[model samples]
Target: MKLPVLYTFRRCPYAMRARISMYYSKISYEHREILLKERPKKLYQLSPKGTVPVLNLPDGKVIDESLDIMKWSVSVNDPDSWYVNNIDHQLEIISINDKEFKKWLDRYKYHDRYPEYSVEYYRGKCEKILDNFEKILDSEKFLFSNNISLSDIALLPFVRQFSNVDIIWFRNRFINLSGWMDELIGMDIFQAMMKKFEIWNPFGKGEEVIFNN
Candidate 1:
């Protein structure tokens, strides 16, 4: 039998984290591209919450959250620094990303909704997270360690998106982060994961392909 499948939305930071884990762990699995506005029946059946980044395990287990999916994939083929074996500072970064950064990112990305404030004001709020991350990057090669850790992968996608709203301005303002983010995007893994697939009819497993080189 084939390995289980993962349903994901291409642009979602949450799904990007899960994909990064699977890619780094060298886990092979099928995939389904999902549209947030119109979720497929198959995915919704398994993921009652109707969120992307759902994992359907081979043993019939279903994982709905992105973090859960990430942990599961890493657990299966985890290398040296993954799992609880050698993890340090990964969890702390995750906490900051999920709790503090994610909160302001939502508002900053949709600045029009917060009409009371200028886009620059909200952008500054989001930039604070990037500034904090940039400081960490300035100190080391990765966010948590010299080597790329789960923390870096989990936060990179969101940071990538956070940087894109005003790419030229951001690049000029923070050249260090621009280079770092560019390096991440220049990778084959990120390029493959971010491709857009044409909308397809509702289908069963293996109908769609995952091109994670």
Candidate 2:
């Protein structure tokens, strides 16, 4: 029997999170690696707003939002107890991650486009939130507690992107945050989710990429 199809772009942090959730939950799905510039016609038919990490359920339902995809993945099977926590705080942290910090991240990564400020200025803007995350890691193994949770998975990819922007500076300044992030990134699940796949062509009826635990 055919499983659900998951459309994803390997480099997108949002898509990374969605893939991480599904992989960690041990959900079976057909992975469709799509190029952002040349999206598949089937994807546009399912979601006009066309984005990566779009999951088409076997029942014909489509989930486009990355966070929604993560929630649905864990809802179906949370093997690591990712949802067993203070739901409110988890949601609050992820909200800030996806909204406010992401703004600074975009500006920092593409400071040339947003030439209103120096790249340093945008990097400084991001530190406001990074400082808080640093403090969190200073005390706990994960965001809310020692064990992994939804908030940790949701926020790490963005932080990873930030660290990559200035690796030397990030390594020098964010000792605690780096350590916390390193442990998560080093895990088997992260490695598996990051495996490369060829760009999918719907018309070819090619073999599907299957992600598993």
Q: What Cα-based lDDT does every candidate model obtain? A: 0.77, 0.90
Per-residue lDDT of model 1, residues 1-213, tens digit only: 567788888888999989878776777777777789988888878977888888888888999888788788777777747555335467777888888888778778898888888888878887877788788778777666566667777888878878778788888877777777777778776786776765545754443444343
State the displacement of the C-alpha of residue 48, model 2, in Å, after optimal TM-score superposition.
0.9
Residues 1-213 of candidate 2 have per-residue lDDT tens digits of 678889899999999999899889888888888899999999899999998879999999999999999999999999779998899889999999989999999999999999999999999989989999889888899888899998899998999999999989999999988998999999998998999988887876533546444
Off by over 4 Å in 2: 206-213
Rate residue 32 of model 1 by lDDT. 77
* Model 1, runs deviating above 4 Å: 80-88, 207-213
Against the hidden true structure, what lDDT does model 2 obtain? 0.90
TM-score of every model versus the real structure: 0.88, 0.96
- All models, RMSD in angstroms: 2.6, 1.5
Error of 1 at 65 (Å): 1.4
